[model samples]
Target: MTTERAYRYRFYPTPEQATLLARTFGCVRFVWNAVLRYRTDAFYQRQEKIGYHDASAFLTQLKKQSDTAFLTEVSSVPLQQCLRHQQTAFKHFFAKRARYPHFKSKKHRQSATFASSAFSYRNGQITLAKCREPLNIRWSRDLPSAPSTVTVSKDRAGRYFISCLCKVDTEALPITPKMVGIDLGLKDLFVTSEGQRVNNPRHTARYARKLARAQRQLSRKQKGSNNRAKARLKVAKCHAKIADTRRDHLHQLTRQIVNDNQVIAAESLQVKHLVKNRHLSKAISDVGWGELVRQLEYKAAWAGRQFIQIDRWYPSSKRCHGCGFVQEALPLDVRVWDCPSCGTQGIDRDLNAARNILHAGTALLAGAESCSKYRGALGN
Candidate 1:
């Protein structure tokens, strides 16, 4: 099957390239914030909707004006692309898939997207518009094919990265008889139906002291001073380290799971709601359950594995997988329990929940009754 994949690599830009990219980033941010404001005001003040074409026209008029003519200095592709992105963001908001579009800030990570017309790729090298030399990229891995689009971004840590979106052909993995269910948690990253538990690395906690120290140092530095800027960079580096470690671990874990299982079942957790509890919010966020599941889903698709997410309210933890007995309550502290109706002793809570998830997911894949009807018919 053919799939579009993004491969990202770190690069050290030349002095000239860095200067040009900074301007490009600033231009892109300016365009996005300006267009978003225009659209927002049009809707609220005049009851007028500004579509992409109208926004594009507005950009053209803005560029020609003497006051904003500096926009014409950089390549226009990324500016135009930003408008398209804004349009998509608005679409997602109206469809309830995402929140309203927000103005881009210069302080955060900045990126510019270059479509095929705006860049040239040849012999494993990429040259962006208005640049004479190809980017000096560390070829971590070769692209499967030439990229359809390239996105260059600089994170808060002052590190540069380029992401290439390429079309690649993937062959499905060999069919396997193994199947497993996953239960995600804060203490243990995940427990499998097969009785395997993966320990949560707690990446953020590992760097907690360092991060705290850096943050404290940043707080002590006077605002708008060079010392403060340096201190802030130190803090950003600490955060980057934590995020990098967490992302790497999740990738490895999900890849292993997808490779071992033909059918993967997991609970569809409402992470947004789950994080609202102040007591466990930090632990929950650190565990990266949502990111893990997201990786599992996409990796499963790539490997031709069956991935299933049972409903969030399916009561996987409360239901006894062995006898279909439902418990009135199962508190977070209760890690082990006995099934009263079946007289099953010493059921591991996470494992049992994984098993129940597997059962429910299999039933769903078989086109069985709805969750409500299934609950009603339990133990029958």
Candidate 2:
């Protein structure tokens, strides 16, 4: 049986080590933005001079620009990879899978990494290519396949992370009879088809007062002063804490669901599009739909469960689970409703939706190819 896998672990790095990692990340951003600018300029020139333009010819040459001292700071392989990504993006755009190209910004949280870069972990010492200073690490397990490289990253809040690209052959999860469907909402985190409720915990919003006070202190401090930097760090730490708590809660909940079930069905949410509606956007963001689906994806695969994704337009909410009658209009505010046909009253919206999601999910599981077609229809 085929099984999915990943590389997971934490790292221990000193302050100096972190700075070095940050510099490498900067180098990657510099290369990408530099080429991005070059490509845009070339395309504009071509459009003006001739009738049409091509990105490949210019991007190909851009990759090797560092050869004659044009871009000395860039690693050869990484720069080539960046150009390859541009080419790939264009391919996807032409295929109608993605949007047209856009510019990269320094202000945005970003990083570029080369998969060919050396990363060796022997005992507690981890060595990076061309960098003599080795980082300290305590790996939780003996890796099955050696990691070819590592990606060092820093988020907007200035927290550091390194994703080790090691390989492992996870055993296929044993099968069972249990299957479940879940509905996602803001007021309530999740409601399973079996009546299991996971309450929504708004970690970030819970600390809104503390965050406001920190901003007030930050505003009062003189710009470029040591005190200002310290205050900024405090805010970053607070944001990080909330994110950590939310992740911990998600991990624990998903683990329970995956371990106990052999089949899992969920909605295919268009999270990016859903966030555009400003009226309920904050509530949607607080619900954390994207993160929840992401965790479910890998966890389901790890458990060897049949993971089914029904259509976003599946009308999971407006349809009655007891009968097949569809309610044409169910407002967001009406949390509790009764099925007129079956006389089932006091039906909780989230729970009823979960049942519908499961019904759709179960239909998909019986025919694996149909589920694949369903995902393909969504351009997955």
Candidate 3:
């Protein structure tokens, strides 16, 4: 089967290359903000939405203006891609999939995309338009095919990376009969129906003190000063470290789960709402439940496994797996519960929920057409 994948690598640019890339990043950000502002004003004034083509056409007029003539210094590919991205952002906003587009900030990470036409890869080196030397990319692994698109980004910590998106032929793994359900929680990363518990690494909590110290030092520095800039990078590095650790943990866990199970079931958690609780918000965010679910979904799909998400309000925690008895009100503190209807006692809530999820997913797969509306089946 053909699978699309992104390969990312850290690249060290020469001083001259860095200067050029920085300029490119600035131009990309500027174009994004400019197009977004124009789109917003046009929509409000004329009640009309313009797309990428319209934005691209507007760029010609923008370049004719004295103030924006310098925009031609960088390769036009990245700027055009920026406009395409803004168009997509607005499309998503109009479709209710995301919030309204916002202006890009120079303080944050900056990225630009180079389509196949804008870059060439030859002899283990990548050369982009308007650049003399090829990019010094550390090829950690070999690519199976020429990338369709390449994106270059520089983070707040001053690290540069290139991500290439390519499609490759992959052999699907043999289907497994073992099916399992997963219940996610802050205490434990996840509990499987098969009585397995994966501990939450709590990356953010582990580095909380270090991050706080860095932030405090940052706050003490004067704004726009060199010291403040250094402090900001330190803070960014701390946040990046925590995120990297969490992502690595989730990827490992999801890979193992997907490889072992043919059908993987999980709860459809409304994490945005769940994180609203002031008491548990920190823990909830630290566990990265949403990221875990997202990883599980894509990994399972790639591995030819079934990934199913039951309804968010399916009462996975309240229902008894043994007796199918559901308590009207099960408080968050009640980790161990006894099913009064069937006299089943000492049931671990998370484990029971996992098993219930497994059962529901199996039932839905077996009877998709006749499945009840209450237990919605979301699978890929």
Best of the candidates, TM-score? 1
> Once model 1 is optimally superposed onto the true structure by TM-score, how far is the C-alpha of residue 379 displaced, in angstroms?
3.8
Expressed as tens digits, the lDDT of each residue in 1-380 for candidate 2 is 34324454556667776655666565556656665666566567764221113333454455466763444444455555556677677677768999976766644455545464555567645676545677665567765655665556566666555556655556657888998999988777989999988888888789889988888898999998999988887787787777788888898998888888888889999988999999978778766788888998887876677787888887788777777567889999899998887798988888889998897788776664554454344333
Estimate, for each residue in 1-380, the C-alpha lDDT of model 1 and write its tens digit. Answer: 89899999999899999999999999999889888999999999999999999999999988999998999999999999999999999999989999999988888999999999999999889999999899999998889899999999999999999999999999999999998989998889999999999999899989999999999999999999999999999999999999999999999999999999999999998899999999999999888989999999999999999998988889988888988999999998999999999999998899999998888888877787666666766753
Ten-residue region with minimum lDDT total, candidate 2: 47-56
TM-score, each model? Answer: 0.98, 0.82, 0.96
Model 3 residue 366 distance off true place after TM-score fit, in angstroms: 1.1
In model 2, how large is the Cα lDDT of residue 179? 88
Q: Write the per-residue lDDT of candidate 3 for residues 1-380, one digit (tens) a residue.
A: 89899999999999998999999999898888888888889999999888788899888888889999989999999998888788788889989999998898999999999999899988778898888999998999988789989999999889999999989887667988999999988888889999999887778878989999999999999998999999999999999898888888888888988888899999888999989999999999889989989998888778788998987768888888876777899998999989898899899999999998898888878766432543444320
For model 3, the superposed segments whose C-alpha errors exceed 4 Å read: 369-380
Clashes of each: 0, 0, 0
Model 2 ranges with Cα > 4 A deviation: 1-19, 47-77, 85-87, 99-117, 138-142, 220-228, 367-380
In candidate 2, residue 125 scores what lDDT? Answer: 56
The candidate with the higher lDDT, 2 or 3, is 3
TM-score for candidate 2, residues paired by index: 0.82
Q: How many backbone clashes does candidate 3 have?
A: 0
Better of 1 and 2 by TM-score: 1
Residue 222 of candidate 3: its Cα lDDT? 100
